[model samples]
Structure formats: C-alpha cells, structure tokens
Target: MESTGIQRLFYILWAIIKLNLYILVFTLAGGIVLGMGPAFQSANDVLLTSGMDYQNITFGKMAERFKANFKRSNGIFWIFAALLGIVAYNLFLASQIKGLLWFILSFVLFFAILLLLVVYLYAVQYETTYDISIGNLLKLAFISVFLNFGTFLKVLFGVISILVVTWFFKGLLLFATFSLFLVWSGYATKNIRQLVEGKLG
Candidate 1:
C-alpha cells in the first residue's frame, strides 16, 4: 500500500534521526562555533539530503558538502547582519529625529529582509538539489516566487502549521522539533522544485 503524506513526512523525520546522526551533531556544533547561521544551513543540508527520498546518502558525502554549506551560510549571516545593522541605525535615527520616516524605512527593510529569508529558504533547497551557484540561486528564487506565488504561500503555510503543531506539543520541541521541521522542509522543497520545473500543475 502507498503511504500518505503524513507517513512520508514521518519517514523523512525518521531517516534524519537514523541516517544523519553525525550531521545532527555537527549542526549543534556549528551553531556553537559559528552561530545559528551555519546551524541553519546544516539543517538545510539535511533537508536537501532528505529530498533524495532517504536513500543512498552517507555521512561522508554530507560532510563533503559542509564547506559549501558553511560558505553559503556565511553569506546569509552577513546579509542578516547588514539587515540588523540597518534596523539599529534607523531606530537610532528615529529616536533623534522624532519622525516616522526613519521608522517607516526600518519597517519596510524588516519586511524586505523577511521576504528574502523566505525566498532563501526555498533557494537553499534548489541549491542542494541542483548544485546551483549562489548567484543563480538568487535568480532562481525570485523566478520561482514570481511564477508560483501561490505555491510559495503554501510552503510558508506548511511551515507555520508545523510550528503550531510543535507549539501544542511543547514537550517534544526539544527532541523532535528540528526533525519535524526537516520533514516538512524536505517535502515542501521537493514540491517547490516540481513547481519550478513545471512538473506540477
């Protein structure tokens, strides 16, 4: 019998726990060594590997991609750092100028950064699945978002739904939250690729 989407998602979670223990450990270590940027990218690495339908993946292979993931994460870190810097500067200006202009600018930039974050979430999946360069990945992310705006919403919705689920099961957050997130990301990333490739209607 064929499995349902929930079953498949659970299987993806199990695969991560079972097959990618080293990656999980490294994820924790990366978070400590370099901050959550590398850790987030490490999770993306697992999401990409999970896209492979949980087959023929080895720790050595995932480890080989570490440098690339770290590089990608480093770029992401700087982008976020810049975003934070802008927000901080604008807020300081707002306090001094006593005007809405700086506050508005900061607000707009916050949403802009947030949008790019969601875009990059999808883009990293593409990068892992296709080994696309960062320059091309940015292009691909925008194209995917423009062409499949509805699909993009669906991906974000899935993530939010998962967060709600985890919120209800707060006790599991420590042990299972990351794994559950990977499962959805893995599944959603695959679908996003299909949408981008015109394979899904």
Candidate 2:
C-alpha cells in the first residue's frame, strides 16, 4: 500500500495532461457554442441589450436548455475533465492506496480543472456577464471523468511535452501551458494522496 515518488510523479503528470486537453477541447467547443454556436448566438445579443436575461425565461426553461446544449457533440470538454479524475483513481489504486480518499482526490482534481476552465473562458470570451447553469457544468465534468484511460493517457502525455516547451514553441504555447497545469496538478494530487495514505517516507 505504498507508492514511490517516481510513481507519484507519473500519475501527477498524466492527470495534468488529460485535464489540459479538456481545456483545449472546451475552449474550441465553447468558441463555437457560447462564442458562435447558433443556439447561444442570441444569448449574447440579449445580454448586451437587456443587461440581464435571468427573468426572461423560466428557470426550468433555462435548465432544459442547459441540459440539451451540454449533451451536444461539442460538449466533450467536461467529459475530458472527468476522465482526468478517474486517472487519479487508477494511479492511487495501482499503488495499492485505498479508502474514500481516492474518490475525493479525483473529484477535487476534476472540479478544480472545471472551475479554472470556466473562469478562464468567461474572462476570455464573455463581454460583461453571461448566464450558465451549474447543473450542466457538473454533467460536463462527469462526461470527461468517464472516458477510457488509454486515450486519456495519450492526451495527457501530449500536453506534458507541450507545456514543458511552450515558450519556445510559440504557436503551441496555449496547448503547452494547459498541458503543464494538468501534469502539475496530477503531481500535486498524487503527493497529497501519498501523504494521506502514509506512503510518504
């Protein structure tokens, strides 16, 4: 039930990479959706004109729309994030770590990435403000969490290399930076898990 430092690092790296890939995908999809998707097009115009649309539609209508939009093909961003958390689960389990802690680590890791992505995207794309429901966000996060690991690892690895050399690469820097964060996040997460399980020497 002990994990070595090197093992911890690998899982950490994998976690971060997958997390960033979710960001990249989400950024592009969001660009198309909230950014320019036909469905969300009027959303911005309405906001700009009225200053708020919260009262225009019933909360139920808003929830329904959120569910429909989040399940669209372009909504794989959160799915990727959720997958990253599962990676954390595997890393701990493989190292013989156990208990509710694994699930908590995975959830926190997934949540942090999801929160960071939402904040970054809102700041980057929205004018002054926008309305998004939390229920859909959670749904997106779960989709990402539930993806297959082999695919997730490949994505995670790609992000790590990019992040490590982003400044030099220029055009790929966003991808690189995103990758770095995921890897770092994974490392931080694994270390925490190790400490909790008393695996740290």
For every candidate in turn, the CA RMSD to the true structure comes to: 5.1, 19.7
Please write out the lDDT profile of model 2 over residues 53-139, one tens digit for every residue: 233423344233433544432343344445556755655554464568766765666555544443322221221122344454444
TM-score of each: 0.63, 0.25
Residue 187 in model 1: lDDT: 65
Indicate the residue-level lDDT of 48 in model 2.
32
Worst 10 residues of 1 by lDDT: 16-25
TM-score of 2: 0.25
Best by TM-score: 1
Worst 10 residues of 2 by lDDT: 120-129
Q: What is the lDDT, from 0 to 100, of the residue 121 in candidate 2?
A: 28
Per-candidate clash tally: 0, 14
